[model samples]
Target chain A: MPDSNTNVIEIRNLTKSYGKNRGVIDVSLEIKEGDIFGFIGPNGAGKSTTIRSMLGFLKIDSGSISILGMDSVKDHTEILKHVGYMPSEAWFYGDMRVSEVIKYAADVRGLDCSEEARKLCERLKVDTHKKIKELSLGNRKKVSIVCAMQHKPKLFIFDEPTGGLDPLMQKRFFELINEYVAEGATCLLSTHVLSEVNKYCKNAAIMREGRLTMLDSPKIDDETFLSFYDDEG
Target chain B: MKTILTKELKLNLKNFLIWSLVVGGMGFVCILLYQSMETEMADMADAFSNMGAFSDAFGMSTLSIASLKGFFATEVGTVHGLGSAMFASILAIGILSKEEEQHSAEFLLSLPVSRKKVITAKGLCVLIMLVAFTAICTLLYCLAFLIMGEGIEASLFIAYMLRVLLMNIEIAGICFSVSAFSGKNRMGTGIGIALMFYVFDLMGRVVPDLKDYLFIGPFSFANASEIMSEIEPKDSSFIVGIILTVLGVATAYWIYDKRDISS
Candidate 1:
């Protein structure tokens, strides 16, 4: 477990909703520096909503989120400078080549990611010359991975990061996460895949219907953990 | 902001080219028709005057198509105005909603940039594209005039083009605000707003009672014939256009700042 004194992300009663639809309610979490935190939830369980709210993407109805000791809403632009995010569904300009897409990401973050991006692409075995539209799902996922990692942000937020990766690539991705954690970076991995949380995360939070139902060390097996969904229904 | 601007420009370059060609082509065809119809100018004028309902709807009641400038103002200018307004509407509506429509909002909004900056950058890109489209249309108009060996007063022509540009920006601002507040229905709402404004302007011209409400629609401010004439430009229309644009943009910014991004 990471030292409790060095919390990288602090959420207090975060609530965001769409009209009457439930998004997330009274969600609060604390992720310490260098901790591999897993956010486990089924489809439409508000995992993305919570992460997006923390990242200042969605406006909250009530509550507060602070990252790196700065308020997420008030200091959004500054906070983003130190964060790397991988969304659940990867998308890019369809007409752009893979290299151009990566370069564009680097440009947006004001970083010269050429060397690191090239190395990451090589390691991920992603083709740099293919148009974004022509890349397969897994390949596009690889591009997103490279883009997210190239900046070497202090905090990494991954939403369903392994959806399109093969088993081999998924293993390699976990290894990369471990490497980053070893370097004192915090990671929030949101996924419904219980096996991923059990194998990699030290602490996991389970969400159902836009509320956190569990937050503890991963002690149950994958099948048992998934049975929580059935029990709730 | 710079990065977003560059990306927007890159993505919409093809769209800009296509819209320019369509608008410019309409101008070209109109100018060519003027040459073929020159000999029958008197008859054409009489026919348009007799078609009272049609003239009122098109704002051609007082226009004499016998002259090249009058024909260009009433026919070519109206088409160009409508086309440019549509293009602006599409650009504004697509600016923010396309991300959600394509399910890429997650990827974009996750970046370090704030939501306000994102909107500002995209809005700037839309404005720049509208300016470019207007400039291209103006150049095409000038080319047609030169080919037909007709020289219009340079200042009047410029004033007319400036009005067109302002009108387009006004429509874009309204549509952009609509997009910010709406979700999947943004495009439909934007186009509908433009169409409604157009219909309102037509009604204002056709119905004497509604003429007093001409300030409600943007088309009322964009009078091509008045612009081409030597009379001083109407400051009331300009003021109204400016107010609507400011209000629209301010509303957009405020709503987007508070709105939730639905999954």
Candidate 2:
């Protein structure tokens, strides 16, 4: 029988370090089927590190990280098929046009990217004709956002997804998140944008100093959490 | 693998067009320099012989003021050794490093393909680019001779061309190996090639008695005057050079396949 739990992502003692510089230590979490999971942290609080390790972008020192129930280090190639990742920086080839960048990404992902690309571009208001170097920072962020969500991946991994977006675009992005969550797919978004969790996330994992400090539902009052943070700092 | 190789070939073609204009144009000027020499052929040989063992040491035996092929062996060898190797190394290093430098490694690795497959594909691309470059250089050399009313034998020409080809493989292999293991791509190619060139030249001077023994060194390989005129490469040295090339390629693939690429 298939496992009914269907945990899309699971981590147990996930740790990484660069020599003496600690990235993350013993990060353990689980996101079951059909959940909007937010990973929150202050700057340099291991949010990107944990997310990158999940995507097999950085090596862990001594720990286990798994995606789609498969071991992360050993089965990353398999995991990638079902995941859509949006990096915080969104650095792309400067010479590539927005359309070419999307097309190239789709090709790499082993998908017929054209139809889906057109739909995403239209929805995201991305002008594919312009070169990436020519695009404004927010526009570039939009292009990356479109690329990440377009394939309808089984899981979406966005690290600081709204980093350069305006308030208007951020609102539109949240609506898109709601629609994605409704479809019973999973989303793991890493950001400092706390308001987003209150607006959409089912639950969130708060991080500090490369460790998980809190994991709870957004149904808790935001003002109460803010007070707890203010008192601690 | 084939797809990645095709992309690499396309990129190298652009590099080739640019370098050919630079190297080939310089080659034409060198040919003019050879023609303008005031000394007669016999007088040149006599003057070279007076330099004793140094003449043989520097490959002055075949350094005629007359033979255009010999002139090319002397001058073009210097030109291609430094210029072409630098150009090729840049492209080869970029094969793996460029993706990471542009933050595309994570994006590319996220594909369905395995990391091993990516490394293999990129390596194949580098190999193909090196072979294509050798063939083009040989063709251009032959064409230049034919156009200039010189009747060079195709077989002999081809044999000399293979020497140049193998020499490039050695340089490419070293650069590829460095790029594979290195986190910093910029330094790997430039430093790798420059170090190889320096080692060869230094060995030629410092260990004067062992100059012939150090044929495996890149400086010796780059010195085309000696390589072109000699009927057979020093057996052990030539074999060692080939072995080094193999070692370089093997080390690169092994390191790349196993190393953690997350960051």
Candidate 3:
């Protein structure tokens, strides 16, 4: 990890739940600028919940999240201005063309991201003319990538971004991410993929049952992390 | 906010057109049939007047069904009232809930726009839709009158349509509030809210004991025959209904701001 004390994201005792369902509990995390921090966990291990709670999509029951040194709740919109978030699933309006969806994303940010979006779409071979419903899962992920990265935000949060991508596309996705990270940006990559964390992330946090069980470096092996979840009911 | 508003308008345009056509087209057809049913309605009007609660419930007692205006009020009135209410409710209910239903809430909320701005944008979409629906249906009704060579009271017709618009806004606001609280499309709940309010008005008119409390429901202000006879019918229901509409929208903004969007 690059030596940087400037925290891009800081979470302290974040707690969120959906009615009777279990959500992240007392989760705390911090990542400095220019760090590719991996958030690894099995399905339903609160990885998404933590990321979403940090993004202010879900109201936290307790604790606080500071993004780019701004409160996630109070300054949610301001935080979003400089952040690019790619959710675990990429589902858009079915009736809209891929081009329209990208336009909509760009329009919301009030930016003409056409140049970046065009290059990304060309690189990913995205059929901008096709309706979103007609696109494959991999293509949808590509569209998500374009929407997220076109603006070139200072911070990037990708949740299970490569699940539906082909091996080549997945490699490309990481490559593009590396280029951005090289530009003094910070990233929080959440996924269940151990290889991605090992090969790409500088550091990681293993979450289990709504809590961060451990925070370690690239040397943290998959066998130990996988065993932690396999041992539980 | 402008971006989302335009997007919502574009997305919801198809459904709006469909609803406007179905409801207004039905009303237009009803007006066309009035001339053919003239003799039948004249006989039925006298018989209906003696039917007590049934006639009163439908406002056939106060307004004679012998004339086109009266017939339109008694027949097409019910159709438009029910149809427009359903349309408005459905539009409002789906405004926010569909984002969650399609699992696009994360994509939408991830933007720099705040929850309040999202609600406001969607609320404005609902308002613009309600207005367009009213204008389209009103134009169709006017066209029908012109086609039939019938002379409808312009002031009374305007008043009736305005009440219907107000009623639609009330229903839409309440359903929009439900939309904010819901994680997915609550079509049934939205329809039920509209139907419940209507049943209350119908029962209030039929049951003498409930008549005084008629102002509690939106239909009380929108009874076509009431507007037909007394163009400026004294009903405090619109005030109550409008206030509730404001409260409903406010509640939507409040709840959506705090509610946890499920993954």
Q: Against the hidden reference, what TM-scores do the models get?
A: 0.94, 0.89, 0.97
Among the numbered candidates, top lDDT falls to 3
- Estimate, for each residue in A21-127, the C-alpha lDDT of model 2 and write its tens digit: 87888988888777788887677778888888887767778788878878887887888888888887787766778887787667666678787778777777888
**How should the candidates be ordered by TM-score, best one leading?**
3, 1, 2
Sliding window of 10 residues with minimal summed lDDT for model 1 chain A = A224-233
Over A1-233, each residue of candidate 3 has an lDDT whose tens digit, in order, gives 43478999899998888788888889988899999988887788899898888888888899989999999988999999899999988988999899999999989999999999999888887899999999888899999999899898889999999988999999988988898899877899998788898899988888888988556475567677677578462
Error of 3 at A177 (Å): 0.2
TM-score value, chain A, candidate 2: 0.91
Ordered by lDDT, highest first, the candidates read 3, 1, 2
lDDT per residue as tens, model 1, A1-233: 44547989999998888789999989988888988888887778888889988887688899999998999988888998889888877887788899998998888888898998988888889999999999888989999999889988889999899998999889888888888788778899998788888788878888788888656576567666767576454
Q: Which has the higher TM-score value, candidate number 2 or candidate number 3?
A: 3
Q: What is the C-alpha lDDT of each candidate?
A: 0.83, 0.71, 0.89
lDDT of 2 at B190: 60
Please list all clashing residue pairs in model 2, or write none if there are none: A57-B262, A58-B262
Steric clash pairs (candidate 1): none
- lDDT, residue A198, model 1: 78
What's the best-to-worst order under DockQ? Answer: 3, 1, 2
Error of 1 at A57 (Å): 2.1
Per-model TM-score (chain A alone)? 0.95, 0.91, 0.95
Range of the 10 consecutive residues with the lowest summed lDDT in candidate 1 chain B: B225-234
